[model samples]
Target: MDLLGNGPHVRQARRDAYREEDSLRTRRDRFKGFTNITTGSKGEGLTCCFKSDSDVMRVIDNVMCVEDGVNCNNISREITFMILNFRYYYHGHCKLRLGRRDQFIHPFVRRALWNDEYLSKE
Candidate 1:
């Protein structure tokens, strides 16, 4: 749909694969120019601590800047945007889709992406 004009460069996923750029805060999976999620309920936040590019860095910053007034913990919030994770080296993409009424992921899925039994079972 070309919703986003261009794909953002994800850092967290990149850092996991390769450690080339140490200057950027690789731990922050923030992309820049996320001006839309603020008005919506289905917002996104980055838990990973790796950053690869400027756009990502900015996005992460935007999420962190959310005020305490926003009650995001409420599951009623419908998260439409996908907070993606990417690294610079491997060019692999990992997207964490979040939705309201969804429970926390299983421990296995949270751990090794492959050892995650949920994926194998599927």
Candidate 2:
């Protein structure tokens, strides 16, 4: 009883589907709290941006890569992880309200989030 039937194209498509599913899962797990993701040009190359939603006590680790987008460099490496300490200065503490999921983050807002000192404490 071949539930998936039998065809070269069918098998290839199924494999591709599985691969895509796995890739999406990897991104989701790697960037659990991230939301309102979008892609656009940054300087000269394309970039992906999203707001994380982890609580003040959560630890930030791991570099995240998104589908059809560039790798996140600023938050990709090791840092002291001071989001909790500076949570009060930001609006939602940990829950970044990024508006529509399709809308790219504003340049000013992105710059604010990507602030060097803030991103890499200690």
User: What global local distance difference test value does model 1 have?
Assistant: 0.32
Q: How much is the lDDT of residue 2 in candidate 1?
A: 24
TM-score for model 2?
A: 0.24
TM-score of each: 0.17, 0.24
Instruction: Go through the candidates in order and give each one's C-alpha lDDT.
Output: 0.32, 0.36
Q: Write one digit per residue (lDDT tens) for candidate 1, span 34-56.
A: 32221111112122233222332
Off by over 4 Å in 2: 1-4, 32-122
The numbered model that scores best in lDDT is 2
Positional deviation of residue 39's Cα in model 1 after best superposition, in angstroms: 24
Candidate 1's TM-score: 0.17
